[model samples]
Target: MAINARHRLPILLAAALPIGLLLIFESKLTKGADQVAPPTSAPSPPIAPTPTFTPPSGPPTPRTPQFAPREYACSRAAVAPTLDGKLDDAAWASAPWTDDFLDIEGPARTAPRFKTRAKMLWDENNFYIAAELREPHVWATLKSHDEIVFHDNDFEVFIDPNSDTREYYEIEVNAIGTIFDLYLHRRYKEDGPAEHGWDAKGLRTAIHIDGTLNDPSDVDRAWTLEWAIPWSAFSPPVLTQPGFTEAARNAAAPQIGEEWRVNFSRVQWTTTLEGKTTTKPLTAPINDSYTQEPPKETSVTFPYQKVVGKPEDNWVWSPQWQIDMHDPRFWGRVKFVK
Candidate 1:
């Protein structure tokens, strides 16, 4: 289902009581600035527009969020681990894992068919994230770096160091180690796109598959990945022309007490075999994300031969209570710990 970026839950306006209690209610009442209230007719002045004020930070989100943001404390790694996908390093012995992911629409809706969990460990040089995703059929085609990796079964990371709802980064990777990294200026409501021009320099990532990839016959267990993002790499400028805030400019590294907005997402798609080569049709289960109904027919691969289905499942560390990942209000908080 496609969520309308412009759609916003309207604020509930308070009902007006009886006119006798109008003044007692303390609601502001106004009169015309240049109007003559007398019986004698006089030329009336033009109406003026009520002024609107915008905050310096960014556009205001809904006063009442669908759910509260979750929080996790990322402990410091006593010994920095290697960038290999293998999470068997001694440094991970004491690192605690986050709770299993729920559907992007919170726990009320359908739960993800497979299990997904993640853990975080940080060093002075890099912010580390490790995830294990349970998938029976592991498949991927994209391999080129910076390509849209999410088109295939992928894992994603979203980070907003300043929590300004602006100037954030999203990184995605598939089982084959294909990666796509982009910088977002604000959110979709403010015309945010995955800015491909911005790059994550010196970012280190690796993936390990427990079973064969792109093989339909075999039953795969799970895929694990580890990402090490250097603090210097995340300092790139963003779009939206607002540039960076004081927090963003100083977000080179997290202090012990600092908190940053973070979230993890996993995309899984169901595939069907039509023939030896031509699988030109894909069928996805009907799942209403928020409000809009899922489209019947979706797009195919770049070659237009292999029909790639829409993501069958979306699992996140912290539920957004909606399908829109661009909304920063529901992102989980990652507190830096010594």
Candidate 2:
């Protein structure tokens, strides 16, 4: 969030609504604060794939104000992967991974420095998600669940079933399995600061770090994670279309081709690069619009030598155009499969 934020961090954000709606509701509703974002650079070349994975079916669908969100066809897990962070199960072998993450700001911005991607699956009991992150230094600080886990480099999930954009679910998990989960009544611009009281009940998550934690002395490989969210917990609806009861939604189960609005984010902060420059470039495309001045530099300091308020990078499964991720309308599309 410190670098290329769509909007500033440190304060709650209000997602931008169309001008017509804004004129009518802007002052009528309470807004937390003002926010902003930045300039572009020469784009990076296309991403190369990992030896074990293949590129997404085609060129990424072009993003426009009304472009269709990126889409993935999630297969049903014949045997759910064990929630052990290793991703050693057979189900994962067949599940196609998503394209590498892009600058949350969109194609016009610089691509992320590291490789990050995810895949999905489902069974009658839960919806499953697994992600692989390439990192040279694997580290973490948070441990308590529901605490703001994003302070450290982390992976996040946002889901808005039925796509009403409200009454959605979000979960953040760090390298060591620490978690922060919450439910949003609506976008923060409307009504939010989504309380942490409602947990992802029956949630199962785990992490496997490929390198030493806090020991930046050696080059690390990567980390992988597996998490599951139960259908029953996601059954509750603050509101829904007529005659569509909670029981009915659960009963239908996620059948092949059914779609849901989902997106993923990675928050990375710049740390010391032994003997490298102390002041790091802040234009390195980050998340949420916390990005600052033109070619600005932020001082990296501390136990980790990373700036306290600055993030190294903000990468995501689907680019959000601006640095904001709260606008679920731009989130990638997840379609179910057998």
Candidate 3:
């Protein structure tokens, strides 16, 4: 009975050892789980800040100011020719067409033709200009630089001495003449400025007539011209500039009231019936209709008293044509866009 009791005690000891080991392993596992338990309010990983959006810079645009172009009519009296250095009734009758005349400081006065006898004027916002070209036959070709294009019987205006005579502007047209504009440097006569550095902005020219062109034997109609150049392009340098001040180039800083030098020219050619093909030349025959320069009358002055509904206001500079009308360098000035 002692031996049996001793063996039972050994078995009980082995069973107890296994149970003790199992209890220790289970306690260690429970402690590890408690330490690593998912946090009830765990702090989320800091979120990166949202990026900001910004717009890119843009170009500047200036505000457009208000302007009023003093309207005027091109009536017969306003553009009457002064044959003998004065506005004479008899001279007006003798003159084929009573129109504004060019009287400059040049030497072409001996029967100075209408080619160089026109006046140019301007006001603040617009460069105002007018001309009355008298021609027996008026015709023009749309094609540019056509050889003997002047023979097509067109009007031409060449303006250089732009303020300082650096670059120049040239315009050609026929009675039905399509207007052709070109630019050149004062120094070079060829089309240099156009190729290199000269330009024209807002150029417009119109012709008024009493008779129809291309129809020979019909009495000539008085040709009239009207155009406006914007202050924005007064200066070729700052064509794209934001304001008129830059265009003014500090030259009196043309504002609402300013003026600038401008000129007008006409190109008339003599045509003869030499068979079907027209034969025309720059010079005219002795018996051809003669155009003499306006007498050295008076300088055209501006700011003339405004007479509502009267022709007085139409005169930009002075009512009388200036002595040096042909000199585009000294023609007239224009006020800024009001």
lDDT of each: 0.64, 0.65, 0.32
Q: How do the residues 69-141 of candidate 3 rate in per-residue lDDT, one tens digit apiece? A: 1112222222323222122234233223223433222222223333323433333444434445555444443
Point out where model 1 deviates above 4 Å: 1-66, 238-248, 273-311
What are the per-model numbers of colliding residue pairs?
Answer: 0, 12, 28
Candidate that scores best on TM-score: 2
lDDT (Cα, 0-100) at 201 in candidate 2: 71
Per-residue lDDT of 99 in model 2? 88
Global fold similarity of model 2 (TM-score) = 0.71
lDDT of 1 by residue, 23-136 (tens): 101101117588866887777998654232222233224764446677799999999976677788988767888889987767765677789999899988889888888877
Q: Evaluate residue 286 in candidate 1 and report its C-alpha lDDT on the 0 to 100 scale.
A: 23
Residue-level lDDT tens digits of model 2 in 255-274: 67788899999987666553
Sorting all predicted structures by TM-score, with the top scorer first, yields: 2, 1, 3
- Specify the highest-lDDT model's number: 2
Better of 1 and 2 by TM-score: 2
Each prediction's TM-score against the native? 0.70, 0.71, 0.42
